[model samples]
Target: GVLPLAGLGAWVAGAGPVVLPLVIACFGLVAWGLHRRRARADCGETKIHKEGVKP
Candidate 1:
């Protein structure tokens, strides 16, 4: 929440050019991490579901 507020403040302060890419990158990283975590969970707990699914 604070992170979003800080980014919003930065945008309001005319720092979009610099902050936008960083915010986008951060969201990308978070999404990637979440996907990896879910994939790992599926791989661990669902052998039938993970059959033939290569890493």
Candidate 2:
């Protein structure tokens, strides 16, 4: 949210085309971090449909 808002502000301030790409990259990083955390929580398996899956 902050990254996108800052990017928008930069674009409004005439920082040119770099703002959107930067914002997108920031969002991607955030999403990747979340995905990694979730993967770690499931022991890197990415799917845990059974109740006895946890060690």
Candidate 3:
């Protein structure tokens, strides 16, 4: 997320002040998405592995 946003900012501002906020926002969104995914998995969600593996 941050990677793409920083790219956008750099394209827009050419390595100026706007890049920082864009990078921060991108990072925040990615972090939030990861946190949400983790939370969902923790609350009794079952994941299936490959067939050869024993559970």
10 residues in a row with least lDDT, candidate 3: 44-53
Clashes (N, CA, C under 3 Å) per candidate: 0, 0, 0
lDDT of 2 by residue, 1-55 (tens): 6999897686756966767678779989999999999878887454554534665
Query: What lDDT is obtained when candidate 1 is compared to the true structure?
Result: 0.82
Cα shift from native, residue 4, model 2 (Å): 11
| lDDT by residue for model 1 (1-55), tens | 6999897776756975777788789999999999999999888778865675755
| lDDT (tens digit, per residue) of candidate 3 on 12-51 | 5876676768878998999999999898876534433343
Which segments of model 3 are wrong by more than 4 Å? 1-14, 46-55
Clashes of 2: 0
Supply the global lDDT for candidate 2. Answer: 0.76
Instruction: Give the poorly placed runs of model 2, Cα more than 4 Å off.
Output: 1-16, 44-55
Clashing pairs in 2: none
Question: Per-residue error at 30 for model 3, in Å?
Answer: 0.2
Rank by lDDT, highest first. 1, 2, 3
Q: Candidate 1, 20: how far from true, in Å?
A: 0.3
